[model samples]
Target: MSRKSETSGDRRPAQADALTLTGRQAARVAKRRRVMMLGLRGIPNVQGGVEKHVEMLSSRLTGHGWEVEVVGRRRYLPVSGPHLWNGVRVSPLWAPRMMALEAIIHTFLGICFAAMRRPDVLHIHAVGPALLVPLARLMRLNVVVTHHGYDYDRQKWGAFAKKMLRTGERMGMRLAHGRIAISREIAETMGERYRVPVAFVPNGVAVSHCDVETGVLGEFGLTRRRYILLAARLVPEKRQIDLIKAYAKLGNTGFNLVLAGGAEFESAYEDEVRALASRVPGVVLTGFQTGDRLAELFANAALFVLPSSHEGMPIALLEAMAHGLPVLASDIVANRQLDLPAGDYFPLGDIDALASAISEKTATSLDEQEVLAQTERVESAYSWSSVALKTLDVYRAVTK
Candidate 1:
């Protein structure tokens, strides 16, 4: 019930002495919770996967009796001090970028902030933030760098930018005290390419938040009768256009296609997708819908599809399943390991096959028992409390 807001924050230099819970310790007794500073693109649900992950994780961890902090961009917050939110200590640090590219600025502030206020453990979510490893090591802080994905896979990074990200990833993994990979695919990539041992912890979802309603279909010439959901950024690897072309081949105008999520970069790719939509019917673009709105779009759908070429445990697909919409995702290793039915699997980048699969599943709906089974599985496996515990284990291993 009582609190201290560091509004400021992680170095893995030393581990704190573990404390035991006493019956008379007062149920509300605020013990010494680890000072954890999580690295993210931004915080407090800033319209991205990392932000959403942190927001949900903070609430669940705090509920589990951990003093949580949700730090994010300073520009979004009114005050420049540490503020408390839902029982977590949140320190939002801000700095002006002084470079042609924002990566240098992002990396600089992450390291500088971690250096100033050393946390019991530092969990860096963004690859850009992983560049802080040396600084964290210098501070003797236990660093747990999470490899989000191959950031340089394809976006608009020059040769130098790509090299820096790859080099940074390689170096950060080696320098950090512990490593966390969101998916086994990424973990293996780390070991094979970077030679770092990583713990696999997939992203979590809020089941309660899965309940949703949406007008995306009506707004974009789609009918509620039936449709497929493909929520992802309009980037190359996401392969949204591939879905568009495949939908054209299947030519299921009765069942519309809803493409949520905005363009990260690669404006050309987005423009191309839009152009294809102009020629093709039944393709609706709902730009960046999240929270309840995102839930509604997935909830009302006949089937959800993710035609991505690469992924590191996409929460989007998990959210779709939570909505009880049987998924028809790319047959990537990540999707395969999700332990879903074989009927849900589809070939990656094969538009005709993906579209045909969507049409075949449009008439089928998940049974109530199956929905409950999937929902319960997601709740236990990817719950924030569970994720936080796994994360703490990694921290404990490093500090010990």
Candidate 2:
């Protein structure tokens, strides 16, 4: 008897079969893929750019079906033990509270934990934590280092610390399986310096939906559209002092100058900022705001200013634009990468220039069209979802 002829029902199309196989392969990779992130303070209400970056990136990575665990410093994390945060696991590890010793010690401990857990990829954030890249490599772990910025350029670190950071940059750039930089300038600099291909995955901002709540306004003695806001950690490189001096130069402009962040560790610099703010009229220091409070500050501000001398792509600047607030940042390489109009930037560390810009910006408000355009621009360009996808590509590349 002749065998039944194969029909469409018996054999699938070649393209269809390939598509099915690809889908299965993707599912298998997602199921088995795991990444452990370290080198940030923690997530969920943590301050600092790196912390916020890790928080947003790790949460979105879970949506791609990759298992994500962030190793957090126990001193900074609000909760104890391992817990799930936004579909990503947070493993709190202990570290000394000292500013200089905390990151390295915490990273060393995290590396040991990573060794035991043996995540498919050990993703380390920032140069300070990147110091342990060699140790992570020694354990035969697949390490991916993200250069947030040149930490050695910051004014806070001492000579030895700066040397260590430089060494970390060297080792992380040369030794890691994959390298990522948060800004084009950083990626280009590291790539040219090390002669390695570095991925440029920028920091992102989430557009806030929170209403302009007046509770936080009243609490901080701020009025809607009547205050200039600077929200960043109390650090030397952030140049809060420059902004404060500039705001002081504005005299009585009928606008309050609000500093909306606090330091991770108590330092003389924090004390100095507080003292300076105390001396200036119409200047308010709101210590370390998160959640709706920060959103309100952004939503209601007349203008936002970032006078930082160093950054890896400032997330606060993006958040300010996302809130449709007119922004004035220092003309630094990192801030310039955002491609804001030349008029929006002032000479770095120039108090007179910053004061003039802030005066001009706050005197007039952004029209409805201007506000919408700014918000749309930020949302389109710097999206956390987009960052997650790009970062996933890097992880996959290194894994392969």
- Writing each residue's lDDT as its tens digit, candidate 1 over 1-400 gives 1123212123222211112445456444545455455555455545566777777766777665666555565654555678777677777666454322444565566566766766667777756667667877887777778777777665556688778777768767888888888887888878887676888877887754544345644566655537888888777778888888888887645787888888644467788888998888878888887666776677677878887877767888888887677888888777786877887888877777876787778767778898899888877777777787877678778767
Give the winner by TM-score.
2
Residue 131 CA error for candidate 1 (Å)? Answer: 2.4
Model 2 regions more than 4 Å off: 1-30, 212-214
lDDT, each prediction: 0.71, 0.90
List the candidates' TM-scores in order.
0.82, 0.92
Report the C-alpha displacement of residue 136, candidate 1, in angstroms.
2.0
Model 1 residue runs over 4 Å out of place are 1-31, 34-39, 74-82, 95-100, 188-196, 209-225, 264-266
Looking at candidate 2, what is the lDDT of residue 135? Answer: 97
Give the C-alpha miss distance for residue 268 in model 1, angstroms: 1.5
Q: For model 2, how does the per-residue alpha-carbon lDDT over 294-374 read when each residue is reduced to its tens digit?
A: 888888889999999998889999999998889999999999999999989999999999999998897788899999998
Candidate 1: C-alpha lDDT: 0.71
